[model samples]
Target: MAKNTVIGFLGSTLDASKRDSSRWQKWRPTIGLCMQQDLRVDRLILLHGEKHESLARFITQDIASVSPETSVEPHRINFDDAWDFEEVYTELLDFAQGFPFDPEHEDYLVHITTGTHVAQICLFLLTEARFIPGKLLQTQPRRGQPDPSGSWNAIDLDLSRYDSIAQRFAASSRESTSFLKGGIETRNAAFNTIIDEIEQVATRSSAPLLLMGPTGAGKSLLARRIYELKAEKHQLSGPFVEVNCATLKGDNAMSALFGHRKGAFTGAVADRAGLLRSADGGMLFLDEIGELGLDEQAMILRAIEEKRFLPMGSDKEASSKFQLIAGTNLNLIDAVASGAFRDDLFARLNLWTFHLPGLADRKEDIEPNIDYELERYAAAEDTRVTFNKEARERYLAFATGPNAIWSGNFRDLSASITRMATLSPDGRIDRKTVDMEVARLQRLWTSDRGDDDDTQLSAILGAERLTRIDPFDRAQLSEVVKVCRHSASLSAAGRDLFAVSRQSRSSTNDADRLRKYLMKFGLSFDEVRAR
Candidate 1:
């Protein structure tokens, strides 16, 4: 059997009596802890300060008289101020670091009943965190009992053993997860899992987090939620600062991010605290972080790592300790490969990278998020708008269908919902409203897809070649290329391109008109389709 070892402070007032004879009659907590009938304390590690040495020795001698089998070891732990939490905790941490803990061969008990309140709290924290390998031993005094040695109880540190406490913690965790997810009962298991993990890390650490996702995928909202949650826990006190890195350019980029001393540049009229400094003791959300300039990226890395940075045209370095949450839609790995982003900065933020899926990927969550968007719209516009059952079903069908390519992700859905809610005739969307919204979404998505023809046509004809062409011809040819790409054959493409004009002719060959149009740009249906 493992030997039992008890460790605690030598209580000054509780262990000392007015008279030598009275000390034996009073119930001293430390003495009673070792004198338990069923508990066998093989050794006692009694902690105390320099002033309590005499008390420590006297208690050791007394314990030797009563429990001869218990060997008392005096460990002097000094505290500058017994009540100072930091000092007490630091000293105890050092003691725990150097102490020879042999838990396999000996059972350890931390006697928390005898130390100062600060010391008791520190001891409890260390034991709970497992710095001290021991269970808490609390001894209480008996009022009228004959035995001066009162009752003692050992408390297990594993909180899961306590059902009520475990349930409370579990409920709190669920509430936190919901808060991080914007209170939407999202059905995406993977998304819920990511939010749960983010909640855990957000509450437990101050490390930099990198959120990678497509545009309008809720990166900024999630970052704000993280800040709010941290603030709720009193972890952050400063304001939440946010900046879209893409808008920063030239000298303004450096000035905007790291602040600028007066006369730093032509526009500098006064001292300005930058976003990082403004977010001191709080969170700074850097949206579109991948768009930041290389020079700015270098400064960001330094600021994040050292909490120190030189402001624009400043002689002295400034400091701003803040939590950084970087949001990016770009593939940073690819950006690094292209030398657009710094590798060192990527490595630093990569410590906690979470990829949020686009709306297209998490289609199952659309229903709940739709409800959320409606509720948000109602609050913002002060108009409660809802969709009838059939209207909702119709919207869901189109939103989740193959044609509904949500290129802008949640942003596209939000816009669609907003438009429908605003146009609702009776504060309730019927199938007629749903039909109009569906057509509007189709036209919106088609227009967006069609707008990319400029890039496609430019790639084929070269930027210079396309610029030389007349604006009217360029746009007309761009639409021709889009039609050709979508059609199965040249005749089918011609029919789409000249659908209106062909109706005016008695017998017109649509394929010939399209062929002639393609030839004007020195392109063919096959060539446009292939590109």
Candidate 2:
């Protein structure tokens, strides 16, 4: 490699001082560059404007006189406005690209001090983007300091130390959270806090993390995201292994989780390496962990605590150093009370437990998630699909409405988008498509609703009040109950549920009317809200 050259725009007018013979006494930056013995500017490309052509010649002569070894070349450029960022940028870019460049024998530097702020920024961009392969040189004024020739420093275009880059990193973190949630920026603060903590723990620690949530509430998805995050950080080296404990039963459970030797079971023909062995040096996600039998749970507890387990029909114990992330909808405490789950195993896995909320609890995030689902559908199908303004509004209204149970959480949202995207003609979803999808979702949710909810509701409101209201009224009021449970107050629930009715009422006592309606069923707003 050869020496680096300084390529700068000439501040011809600024550097032309008639009062000084020494030239160094004037403290002009281009003159100051000649004073630095450490930086060898073998060649200097002086870019000048049309008006400064004569001044450019004088400065070039002055530079040559001061430093006989340094070669200076003056080039004139016509600019409509030096102050205009676009004009300055375009002109400088053209000049930088058209220059006779030799990277193997020479390096370069862009003098940022000689031009207007616009020109300075343009030079910085070109250098930073590698359009001009060099660093930036900034010259500072002496301002009555001892050094008359003013100081000079070189600035690398690396922005890693800047606050703006940190802000971008934070934005990427927010994006990662959205990715884990299937593109939903969940508005639930508790859920967001959990995500933050999980991110920290996933990156910093390998302790077992237990995710507890209702089925379809994204436990499995979150577990997978934790694996991905850890993998990205190079915290885990092996592939992620996932298994649903609910599907394992009897001898099959032991064989699937702990491996089995040949002739260990009726159909065993070869030695098997189970999920635990497969997850060595990585993560094992056990979904529905409460369904594991007692015998399997004991062996799993040993594997988690000791990183060692015995293969079935073999006396030798195999060791697999792996991390555990268990997910379950079951309340393990209740399971312990019923002797269904091992107490010691639950304790080991309970060190870090996160409860994920159902879709209904994060209604505010539905709109953004709708757009995300559309984008996801487009990517998967390799076809663009967009919902019209009115159609989007209609779908959002129904989705966030009390009638939308969202029993399947993100799974349901994805399915809904898939259906609408498929049915949409020409990749555009209209009002008709929205209505059909809404009706289909309603039917699916209605069919999915079992008597368990009605039984719970009956227990909460008492059978006496339930019998007084007809089943039709009961169904209508159940929706009202859901709204009230989610609302901040009775007034808010009334405002949402009775928006049209409140408009018609001469006396705007929406909360009072809502109170009276609940009172007829022997229920109070506070009781329903608490539920």
Candidate 3:
């Protein structure tokens, strides 16, 4: 028997023949026929169109009489009540999301009756949404009888139709594979070399890989692209599971990665499968790998090296075999030296490593990324928006300017473009709006930098230095002056020609030395302080 087949039944519930007792006489035989063929139906979802109270009651009674063993779940939906296209789509999406069909379990059977034009469209969208895989079991009105209930006989739907529907739906969901979708388009020489090496390593060995890069440098995106390319070329058969390790810190982290037995802990009232098991025979991406604690790191290493691990509190080992792709921003070498990370595990994962360059290093790609984002946001908003030549130039001028740090890299650029598109006046963005955004961002960025710098400076100056300075120490001091003229006050004269604020303090010893030197130059505290 085929393992993954979904049977869908489509008909109207309002037909008068359905209310007739004779209809059940015919439907009962069809149900018995299905049972005799050893077709095991676990559950049935009864979908009806708007305000068909009579039809709904008839369907409820008919399903009960025909298939008493099957659990029938009913969902009542109407599309005409929706305000707009997005609202209609969202309502349908919500319904699809509520499906209890498990991909690993028994096949789903969707029974749709009381068909309307909008209802048909919803069904089509549901298929394309890839929420469940099922075949249609539609009952059309029979000739001469002029009604489905009077003369209709249940017939198994064609599997080819279902397959065709699924293929088309999948295609619609993934409309394109290009740079616009955070996919690799034209590979640079360096990146191409890295990709080649990664492919070679992944093909030759089963060892996991560690991809190191700053945030928004496209580490996760690149990992997915690599998986797609490898799966296509090597015919690897499995799903790719990506998890952000940073979000999975502390105790909940372990159970999230590894399966847990029933009553393993407080929340483990029932047995739960972990992502690793779910990702079996596929790829598991652990992004922000550096955030993992030492103990969690050890557990991950064991799984990687041994291909097996004991779920929390389980004596029996669970075996999981899959390729690992780890990503992080920290320098593992430094982390290991500082005793913040496991050296052995680092070496194990470092067998194959790829470092993604920041967007600043690839300025050539910025314009293309911006253009792609513009088109993407426009499509998503269902608006016909475009950047004029002047606006594009203005955007680029500020993006590549000296003041642009863009520490968040591609994510920052994407967000900036989205804001411009949303806030553009008369569908046109100007330089003033761009400048205002930049300035606002700059102030926020500088404030964060100032806090970090102050902490570092205070640590270096020591508690004693901080106490005597009064309002003087709060002023910005040059790194060289802070180190060389450690004990001077603001009254220093001509020793260091660099401009010093009145609130600048060198150190007590430097202050005395500076005073003596200033006296020799016929300068005093009042004279230097006044200057």
Candidate 4:
């Protein structure tokens, strides 16, 4: 038994034609809507121009006389031209925003048959978007009969209630998710889910985003892809400006990010628009944002909240409304506890955080990523490169293996493909090239390990036993010892240290292998732990 409310424009021609008592016989859309069978309009909100004030009052009285229980309320919303889409839409939008609509206690209907075509379309859009929270009411006069009260139909615009349209939207959403992932058709369920969520958030919000991951883990690439997607949708009108916060420092950092007036400092020869201003109306990506100094952190927080900041040596404040996407490998919670990061800024950026896992964590995805990297190399070099069947299988086996640490994530894979393609003979990578690449990768990963520096082993080895060992043995043993110290037990330490080599063995005995390996140096797991 909720009351029904109708909102519409006053029909100047139809509603104004009535002056005498017999004028009620003429068909009018507004009056006709309230007179429909079994329809009780408890309230009517009418929109009219200033010139149509008298006409609007006359119709209100006529409707009151015909339907005593119904209350007619007239609202004046005037614009210069009836056909001005911008003006009409803006006026209607303002009305819809300011009006105290009670949709819970009353059902609402927007009468679309009375306004101009532009106004009608705007009202339809508003109702469809739920800005007005109503269904559409379209009325027309009866054709054969001299029916004064026209027939009316209420149209529902909720798209989700329609399966065909919902399916189309679902397909488009999948495409957007794939686009965000660079169209690689990645198979990792976790990464794919993250991409899908990122697409949804990016499309609906302009809030700050936090991307936490290790260096070279595709943070910069992902940020750029997001910017491109938003630009395609016309969400951003300005340029995408990226800055490496790790490289910014001291007074120069302030000047570079917030700009400065002429004679602001010694190097201020001209007025400069900083990175924030350059990104106005678009996005600003701050990579390694944890590296920013405390002073700069304070400034960034103010600018993000207020869209205004005082530049270096300037009295006037500058304004730049930009979306922020912050990237960091550092654990900002630890930084905040250590007094190196601001908790307030962290709270703001932490609202939408996405952690991108390293390439080592998602081995199943390595095959597809390898194919993607090879395609990238071919495109960049203007020459196609393909691996022989045997070589392809060999490379794929090693890549998906535990030994492929991928310390630099996608960056390492990309560079490895670039090297092999460049070194390939006649655009064909064979077994020989694969073998050479495998050996090179082993050396490279060993050198990039946790304890590549041999000197660190001297404390336990007494500087005498260390000299007797080769650099290769020293690097391997150092990494093993470091892992042991961090691990809770001998077996757990062995699992981590032997994660790569255990795959090749016929039988897995990580603890036994580690114990025997330590025995070669006249040491025990207990002895290593004592250090």
Task: Give the top-scoring candidate (lDDT).
Answer: 1
In model 1, the runs with Cα more than 4 Å from the true position are 1-3, 18-20, 37-42, 48-61, 64-105, 116-121, 143-147, 451-531
- How high is the CA lDDT of each candidate model? 0.89, 0.83, 0.63, 0.86
The alpha-carbon root-mean-square deviation between model 1 and the true structure, to one decimal in Å, is: 9.0
Please say which candidate is ahead in TM-score: 2 or 4.
Answer: 4
Query: Which residues of candidate 3, in runs, are more than 4 Å off?
Result: 1-189, 195-206, 451-531
Candidate 4, residues 1-531, lDDT tens digits: the string is: 789999999998866674886776778888888787778899999999999999889888888887888899999988899899988888888999998988789999999998788889999988887889999999999898777787989888887888999999999898888888888888889988888899999999999999999998889999999999899989988889999999999878998899988899898999988888889999999999999999999999999999999988789999999999999999999999999999999999999999998888878888888888888887888889999999999888777864566887888888888888899959999888877776666556646774444444655665435545665787788888888778888899889987889889888888888899988888788778887
12-127, model 1: which lDDT tens digit per residue? 88998765777778898888877889999999999988998888888888898889999999998887799999999999999999999999999999999988999999999999
lDDT of 4 at 9: 95
TM-score of each: 0.80, 0.56, 0.51, 0.72
Give per-candidate clash totals: 0, 0, 13, 0
Native-to-model Cα distance after best TM-score fit, residue 376 in candidate 1, in Å: 1.6
Residue pairs in steric clash, candidate 1? none
Name the runs in model 4 displaced over 4 angstroms: 1-13, 19-27, 34-108, 115-133, 140-153, 450-531
lDDT of 2 by residue, 1-531 (tens): 487689887875568777456655667788778767677778888888888887788877877877878888878887888899989889888988898888888877889888888888888889999999878888877777655457788887776667888789788777766666656666778788888878767777889999998888888878888888778778899989999999999989999999999999899899999889999999999999999999999999999989999999988999999999999999999999999999999898888988888878888877777788888887887898998999988888787866677999978988998899999869889998987787677556645785554554565665333433455776778888888888999889889888987777687877888899988777898998676
Q: Name the Cα RMSD for model 4.
A: 9.2
Which ten-residue region of model 2 has the weakest summed lDDT?
Answer: 462-471
Question: Considering lDDT, where higher is better, how would the candidates rank from best to worst?
Answer: 1, 4, 2, 3
